[model samples]
Target: MIVKPRLPVINRAHPLAKGLVADYPFFERGGTTLRDISGNNNHGTLTSMDPAVKWILTSQGYGLDFDTTDYVTIPDSDILDFGTSPFFVETWIKTTVNNVRQVAVAKADVTGNFIFEMGTYRTLTANEIYCEFYVSGLYPKVLVVDSSFFDGKVHHLVAGHDGTAVRLFIDGVLRGSNVSAYGNIDTASWAIGTYGAYSPPFRGWNGQIAKTRVWKKAPIAREIATLYADPWALYRSRRGIIGKAVAAAGVTYPQLERSFQRGAFRGIKMGVAA
Candidate 1:
């Protein structure tokens, strides 16, 4: 007889559920300081002369909104440096700007040591993700995602070096791959929403960044698939009260039944705490 392990009935309000904090340097909070939710204490400091960057309430939680000119700066640390190790950066972003390159996450200097950019390549599709992986002595290897990310809806974006090649995942799908790899990506500092202090500061992201996660080890395809399905699952399982309210507010009950039919977590039962 085969027995299946019981999965915890996850509470959507609780982000620190089991196996959720596996990624290091995760930023999901929206506040003056972008605290690292991964419990690594690798928080990022907001840097902007004006109030261009601010926090906003998102469906998942609080998210950071950035103007085309605002960005966040993280101090130089060994944790941010991945030396020839498999690493990945994943985040949720929503944007409509596709005309110019928008840097969602980057680590490099003005001379272009290394950069993992989205909405890259001037005139390139706003939905594409770009990466410029380079070590001190090795030649730079640039890769772009096969898919686009300018859907105007919230979408998951991920880029990483999986020990042998560069990989890109858009909405849980392996959209791009490049065999050319690099050794040790070293940088003094890293920036979010823009390229590292480049002259004139190019590729500043103009969108809402909800969740940002950096992992030292590359996640397998199954893990990535789970991450993608989380939002849909949470909406169904955790919104019991809200879903009922919505149904009551509507004129038709059949619509609600249809919704439940299409919803996720069908058989899993959860009860409110008394």
Candidate 2:
């Protein structure tokens, strides 16, 4: 028998929740609209449906599927306009397409002068999944994963600048990091499943994307690991050992106290290493 751990309770007013600007759960069964659960009204509009987009059962519940010609368009908003602030983009994806640059998520202007994309790129030897942030006149930071996730298996991909470095994580493990200046992203719109009109030849992603999240604040290594463990769980991003211990077990205040009195959680390491 497989045992599923109980999910933790999250405080909605916590800073972690507030820092999440765009959250696409893709929970709807059938519709052209994909609602943003971040409470910031950053809903995505579907366009150019070749076979009509719809939600299907994925490893992580219901997820929206996009054909090669379909994509989701999110209008420009202050919440998405990160002006040199630390930011991260994450999504759960599965695809078998190779030899093509496919975009999972992107923010770009109509002319594609400046663009930011978190997607898969084609290389001579293999395809690479990366998070790229670029400025019109500046060098862009592209953090790529060493291994590919194109085996038709659902995998987690995350790319972001954590204040000091641009990092990429696959399935909760840090794969690559680079130190560079990620210029501000001032695009007029954001697209999921395609790169709009970016200069790069990367086009729409022909796969299944379960969820996508954008955070204005940089997530540390521990937080990234925690996210890989429980993608939907909400906890304080920057917390001490004690706070992290409680979250690791998904215990409430009372449960934590009881566990302490019983010495059940003693000597238990916290964070991702645990």
Candidate 3:
């Protein structure tokens, strides 16, 4: 049987719920509105969704697919504006398109020259990963990692800036970092999948995304590692099964139960469920 555990809902028990600015599990569909469970009411609007807001069923419930032409737009709020204090953008992405500059998440002004961005470092084979944020009185630091995450499998990524420096983490491991000062960057609305004023030839992400989140405080490395190692420890969830030993035509509940209890069953367990 292929056991698909029910996705979770986080409350105070969630390790990083403290400064969560927004959380998008992308599990259950909510029309054009991508619900944000952070209780900050920063839900995003699906703009130009190619499949009219497509959500593909996964073991985690649902994952949104983004074509190069669509993106999510979240309104501006003070909580989202880090102002060079401390902040991070994190997400799970799976893709095979490393030949182009793909934007994962970014916040920019109307003219497309402001604040921060976390996206592909550049284009082509083994396209690097990167994060950039502007701090008043200083040029933005373009923190780029030497590797890529476009291997057609799901991977966790994080872009963060502590008060004094910037950091990048991939799959719970620190990929790279750079020393940087801080101050007020511009305050702007958020754009997912694509960035830069949502213009023509957008820096769109052509892939699947699940569980995107942001925190206004710097992430603790130990906490991040803990989340990567034991995601279930932070959230409560139920599990379900399907196929094979799963209940089938004419299979009585008792029979199915016996089968599930005895038959050699396999479960798809993703590493670092966070």
What ordering of candidates by lDDT runs from best to worst? 2, 3, 1
lDDT of 1 by residue, 1-274 (tens): 1111121233445432323332322222333466654445666777762333376544434467778677777666677677777877777777876566678887777675654554444434434456656644654444453334666666787777888887777788776777765566566567778887574256788887766767677656776776776532322334466446644685232343334345543653322211
Clashing pairs in 1: 127-149
TM-scores, all candidates, are 0.68, 0.76, 0.76
Candidate 1, residue 144: CA error in Å?
5.8
lDDT of each: 0.58, 0.70, 0.66
Q: Which residues of candidate 3, in runs, are more than 4 Å off?
A: 1-8, 50-53, 58-61, 123-125, 136-139, 142-148, 183-186, 196-201, 231-234, 237-274
Question: lDDT tens digits, residues 1-23, model 2?
Answer: 11212222334655456578888
- Order the numbered candidates by TM-score, best leading: 3, 2, 1
Instruction: Kindly indicate the candidate among 1 and 2 with the higher lDDT.
Output: 2
Pairing residues by index, what is the TM-score of model 2?
A: 0.76
Worst 10 residues of 1 by lDDT: 1-10
RMSD to the hidden true structure, all candidates: 9.7, 8.9, 7.8
